[model samples]
Target: MAVQQNKKSRSKRDMRRSHDALTGPTLSVDATSGEKHRRHHVTADGFYRGKKVIDTGSNE
Candidate 1:
């Protein structure tokens, strides 16, 4: 019988996701595209500040 492997176990793409191709703090994904949405890319200073607040549920 064939075995199923975890996706992350497979070779990861050397290319950074287009989403991370920008300056931001957290990354979100498009609801449908299944692509990484480059949003909230901010500097550590701004991130800690009120630049953008509220719990995004991200480990931050």
Candidate 2:
């Protein structure tokens, strides 16, 4: 018996890699043009990168 750890131990590592390749990078859209963009680090000023951050109340 043995225990596996992390991504290397997972047999689905290749699948994960493949998905990442297929999607390339995560980028938000303008909902108008199909152009791509990236998001910078989130700030505590209720803004993510440069866009306004919508705070959805907890559903708990």
Candidate 3:
């Protein structure tokens, strides 16, 4: 079994957890589709950075 050597102070504990806050995914707007998507990722219609990179074949 493991045990803490000393009681940690609230300030020290909170300082340790300062960077533990959750953050939402970073998003960028598509120049062509005018939609928001994750950075460096293709849009739903396969558009990336204003250019068609993949053929989603959703148009039927």
Candidate 4:
């Protein structure tokens, strides 16, 4: 079996993992409801891209 000949340095290891940090979901405002929702996702009221895609059947 083969193994690493030298141990990786902390700075190099951290640099490689820089993009591994957790990031919050990107959100955008609904053009009509003015509500915040994740990009490419429907709002709580079932709105997508400023139009109704699903019928939540809510009185609001």
RMSD of each: 14.9, 11.6, 1.8, 3.1
1 or 3: which has the higher TM-score?
A: 3
| Per-residue alpha-carbon lDDT of candidate 1 for residues 1-60, written as tens digits (9 for 90 to 100) | 977575452235434343466554567654434455446443332332234433555675
For model 2, give the 10-residue run with minimal summed lDDT: 29-38
User: What are the runs in model 1 whose C-alpha is more than 4 Å off?
Assistant: 1-24, 40-60
Expressed as tens digits, the lDDT of each residue in 1-60 for candidate 2 is: 877665374556776676665445566643333334554533333455455575545545
lDDT of each candidate versus the true structure: 0.45, 0.51, 0.92, 0.92
Using lDDT as the yardstick, the better of models 1 and 2 is 2
Clashing pairs in 2: none
Weakest 10 consecutive residues of candidate 3 by summed lDDT: 51-60
* lDDT of each residue in 1-60, candidate 4, tens digit only: 989999999999999999999989998989999999999988999999888999999668
Better model by lDDT: candidate 1 vs candidate 4: 4
TM-score, model 2 to reference: 0.20
- Sort the candidates on lDDT, descending order: 4, 3, 2, 1
Worst 10 contiguous positions by lDDT, candidate 4: 50-59
If both were scored by lDDT, which would come out higher, candidate 3 or candidate 4? 4
Residue lDDT tens for model 3, 26-46: 999898878999998889989
Q: Pick the candidate with the highest TM-score.
A: 3
